[model samples]
Target: MKRKYIVGLHILFWTLLITNNVINSIAATRAHNTVIDSAVIFKDIMLVAGYNSIMILCFYGSYFLVSPALFLRKNYLKALLMTAVLLFLMTGWRYLLEFWFFKPVLGFDNYKGNNVSVSYYVSNIFWYYFPKYFVYGLLYFSAENWIRNRNRQEALQREKLSTELAFLRSQINPHFLFNTINDIYSLTYQKSDEAPVALLKLSKILRYMLYEGARDKVPLHHEVEYLNDLVELQRIGSKGLANISFEIEGYVGGQEVAPLLFVAFVENAFKHGVLNDPDKPVCIQLKASNQQVEFSVSNSTVVSGTQKDQTSGIGLSNIKRRLELIYPGKHELIISEQERYSVYLKIQLGS
Candidate 1:
């Protein structure tokens, strides 16, 4: 798409340039002959078309012909030297063909009569044709500049995305650690015999975080194991009757997904849903198939006059941006809040 847009822009620019030059040529002839019209303009454009053909031919062909050798030699100076030589030859040929062949064929009246000399030809040829080469050179330089800036912009975007992703990943690991440590602290304070079991579960989660989750993507099985471990921590923290339920309905198969993609949803549920009150409970369902994965977390929260303080929504927002970058049109996210808050996210892999 980008390349097509650039090409379209270049074509538009050259079309305008050629149209302007045609108008100027006809206007110049009209100044002296007083017999210019659309026919004259068309004729002048046709006369220049022969040289323009050479300009385009050399512009595209000669560069490609020498580019391989230039790259092989790994010498920029030599490559530039070759380019200069090719330009000179092409310019000289264009000048020769236009003056010696095209001018006479078009019945152009030279102010100096039929006789042509080095000085006369040079004055006529250089003045008339040099500007065409200047136009070509300008076009080349502008195109190169456009390409350079485009590459620089793409590089910056990639680096920015990488940095943001790393920061998001960093936040995720520590967030999970904070929650796990809180659970461990509760277990220790209560002097519960399940402290050893909680420690073991923490160790497993930490091992996955250290090894598997650090990667760009992790196996489906590994992520499920981590999710189960997280649910176990929630159960332990809930003291066996917290009314929190997590269910996975479908097989994940052997597919891989981006690490920690499910963490934000789970964390939000645990943070807001796991209340000490027996009247309210959290319901979370996660399901995956070959084509899609869906997560739904809904919880009951009462409307109150007190201010509901929430931290920066960066974690969930980062997940949103990652979905945009990685899945784009293949994902859907719906967030609804009322007496009950719910988040539904579905990603279509096969789409």
Candidate 2:
């Protein structure tokens, strides 16, 4: 997650390791109940710290460099060859440090005054401590490789999810503009007095639509105003023959909703519900509160050859999938048909 968190964990790991090493050093010094001077204790710690520094550096090389470049990159043959070379060199390095450097320069080796042969020291380095060092290096390498793979998988998942979401949201634009543009054309072709007004209304709606389409959410007043303008656009050139009504029961001052989320239902109402009905009004109601928003649309079902079937349109299914993806468990949708057709939607907008 956060860089600081990962750094903190590394710090904690190093702290615990240093603490354990210090405890073991202290236990060994006191094993024979021998009184030790501060000077001797400090020198003992210096020698132990030097060895610890070397091993930590070795482990990290395996963790950060070799694992990714070889082991994780699937160069198994190269990884094995490199590892063998490293171990051979480290064995020689350890023998020189303990027999030559520690005994002469630091005077910290256990057999410092003894006449032990060079082969004896080499045997302890290669046979006794080499396996432990090799195992520790492998542990570090495997742990880092696992973290790398996990992070890669998570990044890929997020990218895929966002790409699909963008495609789904883009589908809304064409489906919506197609119907609105048709309504505007009908007014202009009739040479109706409302043609210019409907065109102007369409322009305003498009201004909002073009800007807000890319956004994840839009404010309450913007959506409410768009819905109102949409109804008025459909009402153009109607001459009071087709009845239509829109109602709002609560304030839309601070609410927010996904862009173009409510339009498909409105468009479907006009298309398949009341387009040919002169006396029956397509009723739309929206109620918004601090925590929730609800919308219901009802109209007389059209039984004309020109009317599109509501159940057979692309708009309904697209919006249904959109709602499921965007709101999931936060929304409820209901559709009923017997005489009049109606669709109701309710959403919990968490504050």
Q: Considering every candidate listed, which one attains the maximal lDDT?
A: 2
The global Cα lDDT (0 to 1) of model 2 is 0.69
What are the lDDT scores of the predictions, listed in order?
0.65, 0.69
Tell me the tens digit of each residue's lDDT in model 2 across 118-199: 5775566556554675567678678766786677556545644654444333423444456557766876788878778878
Error of 1 at 86 (Å): 40
Candidate 2: pairs in clash: none
RMSD of 1: 13.2
| lDDT of model 1, residue 165 | 43
Give the TM-score comparing model 2 with the true structure, all chains together.
0.46
Q: Lowest summed lDDT over 10 consecutive residues: which window, candidate 1?
A: 303-312
Model 1 CA lDDT for position 58: 56
- Where does candidate 2 have its weakest 10-residue lDDT segment? 303-312
TM-score of each candidate structure, all chains considered together: 0.51, 0.46
